[model samples]
Target: MIKGLFETHINVSNYEKSSSFYEKLLNIIPLYEDRVRKSKFYWVGKPGESMLGIRENYPSPLVQRQHFAFRVDVEDIIHANDYLKALGIESTNFYGDSPEELMVFPFMPAVSIYFDDPDGHSIELIAMLNDEPRTELEIMSWKDWNQLHTK
Candidate 1:
């Protein structure tokens, strides 16, 4: 059986631009760079825990966009939108709502923020909460989700 997600790869048009964005946004140092293949790899979450591979796209007209999320601290997820906005990146809720809004997944009772990379791929920052799942609640704004627990 599969154990866990070791690494995920995405094709970027330019290695220099994408790598620089990730470096500045995440402050992650690349672990390896394949000069011949023009691929760069970086550790995510932590070293040896997870990895992200970014490959420079070949000369092709069509592009395939993929979605992925990075597991982060609850506090980080809460402040992600603002943090991203400060970097000139825009974030949205699950419903494409306000950038200041965050999405709460009822099934997992987790919080997340959705954003796009330079290549137009959907990327997310998610944090699993310690609270029990509220499946009946479906999805809601983070504020509403918290209010339910506070009452």
Candidate 2:
């Protein structure tokens, strides 16, 4: 039977630089490293949660960037935007514009903001705004989501 996500591997040009970036971003240290394999990765969150593996990209560089997301509290979504800004990293919307415009997935009733990692990987922080069950996919603005919930 299928359980849940155990780990996800990401390719980076430099191990030290990528590791440092992830350390600050996730606020966790690598649980394991294989020096012989030239790979170092981190196990983030709590036990049985998920692992983020940062492997060195040797020989060939990434031809294109990848996008991935992390789920956080709605308030943390806002806080993360400010946090990235404080670190001089600019946050953006799905269009890669100002993050002040929060994107909403009404199907999941989630809000999200986006930014890039040191290796140019698009990272997203998403927060579910409602506990109400949804059966259909819906897309709307965060403003609409707030108003709907407040009303």
Candidate 3:
């Protein structure tokens, strides 16, 4: 069974800068980094399951509009946003229409703060609230979907 998300990877233009940015934002040392491949991989959230990977690519091409979302501790959200703002990092507000749902950027179910790494790759710092109903996530696997939908 697919237990959980193992990692999320993004191609970057400057490996060192991107690595530093994530390290600073996440407040954890990278589990592994490879200078030879111009890539850096790290683990956050979980000891073995969650990993973040970044690679170097010059003349940064605009990647397709895609984003990876992670549910984070609510307290971390405030600290992360303040840290980003202090460093002059730009982020978009997810919650707009609804005051209760408003976040740093326009999104759904959760309050998300969107920013970029040094390579201009988008990153999101999301505050996963308990109030976000389970129905908000559309499950893919029939087993998981059926289990939750039935509940």
Can you write out model 2's per-residue Cα lDDT over 1-151, one digit (the tens) per residue?
8786677777888778777777777545578888776678776677458778877775366625878777678878867778988777788876776788787876766789888878898888888776574546466667776776788
Q: Quote each prediction's TM-score.
A: 0.91, 0.85, 0.68
Candidate models: Cα lDDT each: 0.82, 0.75, 0.60
Cα lDDT of model 1 by residue, 38-127, tens digit: 888998857988898888874353457889988889988767777898888888888888857777998997888888888887988888
lDDT winner between 1 and 2, please give it.
1
**Stretches of candidate 3 exceeding 4 Å from the true structure:** 58-66, 95-101, 104-108, 132-151
Tally clashing residue pairs in candidate 2.
0
Q: Which 10 consecutive positions of candidate 2 have the poorest summed lDDT?
A: 131-140
Candidate 2: stretches off by over 4 Å: 133-138
Better of 1 and 3 by TM-score: 1
Screening candidate 2 with a backbone cut-off below 3 angstroms (N, C-alpha, C), the clashing residue pairs are none
Best by lDDT: 1
Model 1, position 49, has a per-residue lDDT of 84
Of models 1 and 2, which has the larger TM-score?
Answer: 1
Candidate 2 overall Cα lDDT vs. reference?
Answer: 0.75
